[model samples]
Target chain A: MAWDLSSDRPIFIQIIERIQMDIVSGKYNAGEKLPSVRELAAEAAVNPNTMQKALSELERTGLVYTQRTSGRYITEDEAMIAGLREKLAREKVTEFLESMKRLNYQPDEIVPMITEREETQ
Target chain B: MTSLLECRNLTKRYENKTALSDINLDLTAGHIVGLLGPNGSGKTTLIKLINGLLYPTEGSVRVKGHEIGVESKRVVSYLPDHMFLNDNRKIKYILSYFSDFFEDFDSAKAYEMLGRLGIDSEAKLRTLSKGTKEKVHLILAMSRRAELYVLDEPIAGVDPAARDYILNTILTGYNEQATILISTHLITDIENILDEVIFLQHGQIRLHATVDEIRQREGKSVDTLFREVFRC
Candidate 1:
């Protein structure tokens, strides 16, 4: 799928977040070879330099690593991926809670509503 | 490390009206810079000055440390605002003409792109529709392995679907070391591909900053900012 990037934030940051989500969700498995920067950029409809920047940032975060000759790949560290998965889940929870609070829902009433929706489904 | 393009005190005046005034800018290698402005806002004038099509009134434009001359022209692949090719010639003839004219023009690449568009090489330019003609010209311009690509309104005339094709071609087929300078009013369509953007207004530069920097500092997209800044 094409990258649905928002314009208000930094595009590279969005790239990083998208890749992180993809990695944690197993779209890109651990130790899987990542596509070349040019390919990813073209798919995202972004500049190659910006894609390169996002990939380099991912390297820094230990989600992806470059092998010099063979090119970049997803990190093999399961612990890091698990940690990122938890972090993303928690961020989603925070967002959900904020939206509920804005709708005048009580903080203590959120968990029951979440459980009831899950049960109904 | 040297600037790919440098403009110093560049000003252009057409008799009674000043088009560009006292512009000092230097663009480094490898970045996609957008030259943006509304109608009659000196974007075209700046591009014309860079291409040596029109002489600047006050100052100069240098490419890779030399004045705009044969060497600079050799390195700057320019796509003017309008069609420059003779429509009577066959596409195959033009392909050979480009190969003969420019040392760096890639005949194979141009043909490959034309083939992708299903454009018949034996057909004359006059037979193609306006959109196809624009794409064909873009293919010709992009086929050159030049150091700096100066595209003036490359995406303006075409339809939305053609716009996507043009942007994809631009994003995919570019040399890493070569810088691209795109002048267009379609900000939202191109914001993601730009490293830096220069906003021109009333014959002057209103802003020149990285896309991320502008978004971070302004808390809005470049399109929104442009609308706000140039609002009537």
Candidate 2:
């Protein structure tokens, strides 16, 4: 997948978000072996050190684990992935709601607008 | 374990003009530093001083704790802004030439990159396009396992796609212990890979900070900050 990095935020944070999205979306399945830091950095067109930092942060959150010799792997906990998916969805929805509110749409109008947009699509 | 590069009271002068004045900087190992500035900002002068091509008028530059000389030259791989290779030579010949001159040059890696880029080893350099020639130059320079890689305008003339390839090549080629000091005005193109940046204005050091710090504090890219700081 293409990495769309903005200049406004720290790149390592973006790396974390991208990897988290991949894990939650099942692009990287639970218990599957993740690519090496160098491989991921090259793919993302970022520094390996930055990628390593991101992976370490993921490990801290229990989303990834490292084996001393073999390398890093995605967490085998299915519930953690589900939780992350829900969290990401909620954050996106909150953002959408805020934007709709700014557009002067009432909370009661949002559900109908969503259904109307989905049907038109 | 001295700093990878250190400059003390570094100043450069030619005749009556001062190119760089009273500069002090230290670059440690493992950093990909961006030496950024506009035209005649002494970016080239600083690079030339580090490469030992031009001596400083009143100061010193040390690489791995040694002054810029034979010892430092051995460890510093420099890619000057201008074309340094002979156009009459073929790609293979240039590879051999690099291998002969630089003890750290890895012929195998150079050949691998050439093949990956679909550059014929037997083709003469004169026949290649401008961008291809620059790629060849980059391949040769990065093939060296030097302690410090000083690149001047490595991405200047290339298209966006080629720029990405060039940046990736630099990123993957260097060893972890080595440091890369890339001097360029194309701040956005190189900003993502940079660990730190040193901005120069009017032959003086303007700012030096890590990329993350700048992004966090300024809420913008290096490109935007540079434009704001140096706006005419």
**Per-prediction DockQ scores?**
0.86, 0.70
Across A22-42, the per-residue lDDT of candidate 2 in tens digits comes to: 998889999999998878888
Model 2 agreement with the true structure over B165-204: per-residue lDDT tens digits: 7788777777988999999988888788888899999899
After superposition, the stretches of candidate 1 with alpha carbons farther than 4 Å from their true spots are none
Residue B11 C-alpha lDDT in model 1: 88
DockQ of candidate 2 (2 decimals): 0.70
The local lDDT score (0 to 100) that residue B168 gets in candidate 1 is 82
Interface RMSD, all models, one decimal each?
A: 0.8, 1.0
**lDDT of model 2, residue B72:** 98
- Tens digits of per-residue lDDT for model 1, B85-144: 999999999989999999999999899888877789999999999888888888899999
The window of 10 residues in a row where model 1 chain B has the poorest summed lDDT is B161-170
Q: TM-score, each model?
A: 0.97, 0.95
Model 1: chain A TM-score against the true structure: 0.96
Pairs in steric clash, model 2: none
The C-alpha lDDT values of all candidates are: 0.91, 0.90
Candidate 1 i-RMS (Å)?
0.8
